[model samples]
Target chain A: MNPRRRRGIRGNTSIVESVRLTKIYGSGDISTVALNDVSFEIQRGEFVLIVGQSGSGKSTLLHMIGLLDKPTGGRILIDGIDATFLSDSDRSEVRRHKIGFIFQAFNLLADLTVVENVMLPMMMIGNGASSAMRGEAELVLGKVGLAKQVEKQANQLSGGQMQRVAVARALVNRPALVLGDEPTGNLDSKSSQDVINLMKELNRELKQTFVIVTHAREAFGNVDRTIVLKDGKIESIE
Target chain B: MDFRLVLATKLLLKRKGNFIASVTALVIGVMVILFNSLIFNGVAEGILRDLADYQFGHVLVSKNDGNFVNEDLQLISYVQTFSYVEAAAPRLGSIAWMNSTEGASLNEVDKIVIIGVDPLRDPKASLLYSTVNEGSFVASRGQLVLGSNVASDLKATVGTRVDVKMVTASGEDAIRQFVVVGISKSPGGLAFDDSAIMTVEDIREITGRERETDQILIKLTDRSFQNELKSRLSNAYAEENLNIQTLEEAGEETLAGIRSGIAFINLVGYFGLLSASFAIVTIMMLMVSNKTKDIGIIKSLGGKSTDVLIIFILQGLIIGSIAALSGFIVGSIVGLYLQSIEFSFGPGLVLEVVYDPVFTLNSSLFSVVLGTGAAVYPALRASKLQPIDAMQHS
Candidate 1:
């Protein structure tokens, strides 16, 4: 284990758990191995990074864990509840009420205002936003240093500011887990570092669980532990 | 506003090209249907009004002979005093031969339906007197009025005398001499333009139908009273000597023909709207395709499939409402424009088209429903987009 990895036995409750997870692309002879028999558990409030080269299944693993895609075999437990058996709508409900996603390209609906973007999760939770249920999206926007930009549309912001807006949106629901798939993929070095520092700050302060998939090591150096993958298998834990 | 609608509005407002195309399709569709339906509706109303005003005269009372009035002058005169009778008049008609005194046999026309009217009450019962342009209506027994076509055929003019010959009810050949006093125009542009009019005394003298009239024409305070009058007449004159019927009965076959033509017109309108709905589906599908990534983002943000569907459907509904309202306004104006058109048909028949467009609630509702329904498939396709596929697309 890397020196920065915390030394501990995760106690009674884990926010997420994966058991013998397997994913394949096609059927029979033409099939490709994307992930193979991978298993892991995530403690609440832990900051974890899944690191690998391109096509090494880091993104695939993130997708499966986040419920963005289905696994070919194995089970995923979110907040200690088996999610593998949930209906499609139920899985969407789980994503709505429990999980938050941060995409690399900062998918902050460009047509929506920054505040409106932050309220997206809450709106979708209602399916058709109740507007009465809009909690503290503004507070989360303020926390991401976008207090003054709340009324501005998402497209009006810069790369770093857009990512911050997205971060604000992801955390507005106070979800149990936040999954980032190459969160800084489209940003400059400084913008990438700003987004990473912001995620770490929010993780520490809010004590929210995080699982990020990335190849960048410098920005994620302070994560609690990093799972290193090579050729669809975990090579080591750093 | 629900966030679904809010997002839907934002998407449409932000995408000017798609929004304009969608709205244009709907507007053009509704406009075509409205304009066509209005024009046909106006034509049907004009035809029916013409029949009611100039041909039918609300109700007609006839006898078994059909041409000569049965000797029931007392009941007709009695009906004239009733509250429902705006005007009641006796008319005598016979198939006669007429020729101008100055012209040879070439000027004679056979099978001329010559009708005699009372100069006093006929004007109130039939609006034909109002159409007399150059002469006074039949003023007395020896006077006659000629329709434009009949005047042309007989080579008769004002102050010209004509000889009318017919077989009387007694089976004897009889004749009368009539001086043409006026040339009357036919308001209806119908075959009546080929008929002649004279005093009831003139037709009676020629047909030997002493003190007998052929048909009793009645105009009522309200046309709806015809059915009640028909029943009352049947109860009073149930002997089959007198028959009461609505003027519409005379042209039921013609009206049925016109109705079929109007049905075809309505069908064409429906097809126009159908093509327009297809256009909506095509353009909306394009919009959905362009915004697939947006779909994924919404899904990732916790939006359900139903929310996405609502957004797209709401966009279409908005377009439909705006287009339908605008089309209705424009169609009303067009109906007014068409109402002003006066054109002539067949030999001196100047028709003033009375265009009264009728818009039904069901038609407007149908437009809205069709416009919104056309977008359903596109919306469903957009809603079915996988969040992962959307994210991958970008």
Candidate 2:
């Protein structure tokens, strides 16, 4: 509802754009290219998946797009702003305003309550613990089917429940883009299917762009697009 | 509450054992420092009290190059005229030999310093009357008050007749018999331990030195006026060839030694704080290692590096403040207990613990700064961690 956020939402249809992004690990003879000149674009309100094998740079591309890791070459743009050259503080600001991330391990701060975990992004963006932020967090948790577990410590939750808390946390800020790197990788098959269905449902309802990287391509059933990579290079886009 | 503080509290609570250990370390450090400071204060206070109450009154005025100051009554009257001077009394100091005669037989002979005081005026200028352990202070010309050690050495008691022998001012040997009236135990160091007190008139009559005394002891209404009174006395008696000294000036060497001892205690206390700081550093480093995943999660949630830094720093600060306050309370309780007990170093020196509020507050503040400083490196390391790398850490 803030003027700046409204301006951001109205500014661009392309939520994310990666142009020849490359990330290399190590150096000299032992150096390995984690991502090699990978290029992609994700539009607003699109549900997209990045599919590849274990070493195919799917997580790398997702990390770069989320602004959690910088590309060694090329550039990344989030909500039409060039993000690759942003300072660490500026990158954090961009990430706070424009992107949300969910990891395979759920990555909830175990010591915090589920509501607290969900309220973290909003608090980090200087919203404080205002009743509005708290209400929004509770609303998001309710949407993720975690209304009853909101007061429980994150560590006390089951994998499915913890992932639901993570989902609530990711969407609490209503970011323009949400990135997931194997979000359901550690869940049971039923739990995984349930989480994927929840994510699809939330995407349909919220119309926020979602970029997910995973090995279980068939589980997605249908998405707006899928970017396939092989050996750190983009092989195809469907 | 700020999210950083809330997260820091939760993080510290999550590791209860480490948190308690860190607090205990800092508490011990603060207690050690406070204990050392209190002991130093106690010893210094005991020494100064002994000097002011028994040996040196607040100011001592003596002849610069003679055994006695002539016209002592006039000098006493002149000194007492000052509003700050509570009382002025004359004292005559002489080395003498004493032997106790019980049953018409001399039991033991001892060499002693004899101090002659004005019976009425001396009581106002010194705590001699209160220090009498048995009988009472000298009230008449022949009455004698014996120090504890001198009384023990001479095998004398209240009502015992003792012969005191001394060389007169005219270089003639003189002897007089006196009955002991009191046994006084003044822990004003060795000076008062091997001495005896009697009426100034009695000493003058025995030594054939009438109307003269060794020193004029001046007690002040407040001890802080010692220097000002000394300066005024010096100026007033500039033509009298007198040496005027303040209590501090007279006890300079002993005070210097005590100062050195305090410095050493402060060094030891700082070393204790340094060791505690090291424990904090190690504990904070371990905390950062254990919370790497949390750091990554926070950063991934759009927390800046400064946010992570502030969280860790706040943890250290909270621990330090709690420990410091606990240590101060515990230390004060222990100091009060110590104040109830008496510690005697020798025949006439007893010490009781003392506490100063300003010193205690400064010590606690120092501990807080050290604790906060100890966390800087670990905080920086946590703040600088890359979100991706930290998330990958298992």
Candidate 3:
């Protein structure tokens, strides 16, 4: 890590870091370390791709970074705040206001329509944000090409369409970081391209940080950097 | 969480079949509990009013051997003592034969209990007087008030003179001639339907009874003190060979039998309602199981465990409230309908059922409490579910 190399990304800053993060499941002889001494820095407005095979610790790492889970050891810093020391409710606040997540399964609440799913985060803010933020939700959906399908239920949408709805929902709050885990895993190639392009567009236009975990090489087209994880360790950062 | 509430309600609506089933189970539970309360309250009121109006006048005093006071002079002395005592009267009772000439004619005569009463102190007198149609209860010399059944049986009208043959208390048979001064309709049932009423002296002379009464009817200032007064009087007049008893204690064995019978019915009714509560629990547990995945999703999306608890609790409250209100409405309607019909108990006692408003409200509240109580376990389980496991649930 040369100072000159770090200085090349001028005026841009890293909002996340995993300081010797480790996660172990089980105990005694059967202990399995899911994440071992994993460390990385993700900068603002950077569309970084994490490429890995199955069980390569990609999802677990992404989950830890997104504050959806707690690391068994080590501290995760988000925006210079020590996230591991925060309370469960405080962690939830960080997850709500600071980060957005898109899942490979397109975890849209099936009971809600596309528009309601997009308004999901706004509603979760608990201040009755629906009345005030509805227009923003509509605009985000329009950006994701889901304006026509807004009233249709999530269950009625195709795999690709559901992924797009999930994306709209993730970005509805205008979060600082968008952490997607295999977001295009279940979509067709064309839909995957559309979703990937949308993420890139959001990162470029909104100066939003993007950290995506995926195995599809085609989905990472023209990303600023790719961090390849292998056997619970970083293999390369290109 | 605002989103959790909106999402939970949507999930409930989406799973409409499960929601309907759960609500139905709760409604049935509520109905059973409410119906039992209505029946119990109705029977209590029904029996108490019937005894108070037709048989016991709040209290009764009598000789230890159950003989009526026959000396008119002694009776007046006893009657003048208590200022709080509203009415005191002596009655002589005996079994007699009644042969009905209409409605049904059997060769075997119907046995009826004859009562000797002071016409002025009898509440039944007004009702009997109104039903007379042809006679008066003036208790003139050698006159009688014959019940409708007895009058019909003997084919006797107010002016008809009939012979009443009976044995005096001395075990001697006597036949007395008397004009039917009044013909009164029977009060559906009790012991006196086919009975007749005579002056105290008439019963004593005919029965050869000497200064004895079957019972003394004592009306008190407060009906609740009937038992207390009966005990006190029994102690006060221990030497007089008189026994005082409240209507409930007087018919102790009978009332105990009635109470036990009603209690057994109520126990069975509660058992059924408890099983209905179990059904409600089952439905709620199923709801929790079905929504496990949705719960996980919401938790992951910033729902606290408390938020989950609120959603389920609100659902249970809604279900319980609706069921309680519906059960109350339906139960009252049914109870009121049953009250509209007049039923006979036994000889001079007809039961007119009255729907108790207090019981209705209490039963409604009971249903709500029971239904909500049934949901507490399931709601708690829903709240304690792990977000990770719940999310992974299919």
Scored by TM-score, the top model is 2
Q: Compose the digit string of candidate 1's lDDT tens values, residues B1-394.
A: 5678888888888888877777677667666666666555555555655666655667877877454444546766767766897987788778888888564455888888887888887888887776567777887888888887888888888888888888988898788788888887755565356788888877777777777776788888987888887778888778766667786775576578867887997788788889888988998898898888999888876677887889999988977776677666666676567566654344433443443445633455566787799889999999899888976775
TM-score: model 1 vs. ground truth: 0.89
lDDT string for model 1 (A47-123, tens) is 99999889899999988888778889988877866777666566677788889999888887788888888877787
DockQ for every model comes to 0.49, 0.70, 0.38
| Candidate 3 deviant stretches above 4 angstroms | A1-13, A85-89, A128-130, B61-89, B95-113, B118-167, B175-188, B191-201, B210-212, B216-253, B336-353, B356-358
The stretch of ten residues in a row with the least summed lDDT in candidate 1 chain A is A1-10
Which scores greater on lDDT, model 2 or model 3?
2
lDDT of 1: 0.78
Error of 1 at B39 (Å): 3.3
lDDT (Cα, tens digit) per residue for candidate 3, span B88-172: 6666777655432333543223455677776666643123334444677645448887877677667777776666767666677
Question: Candidate 1 i-RMS (Å)?
Answer: 1.7
Q: What's the TM-score of each model vs. the native?
A: 0.89, 0.92, 0.80
- Number of the predicted model whose lDDT against the real structure is largest: 2
Which lDDT tens digits does candidate 2 get at residues B1-394? 6789989899998899989998898988988898888778788878877777777789988888874546777877888888999998888877788888667667665567889988899889988777788999999898888888888888899999888898898999899989999998876543465789889898889888887788888899998999888788788888888889898877777789998999999899889999999999999999999999899989988888999999999999988888878777787777777777786556546875676666777777777887788889999999999998898887
Candidate that beats the other on TM-score, 1 or 2, i.e. the better one: 2
Model 1: pairs clashing at backbone N, Cα or C within 3 Å: B68-B214, B69-B213, B69-B214
Docking class of 3: acceptable
Docking class of 2: medium
Model 2 gets an lDDT of 0.86
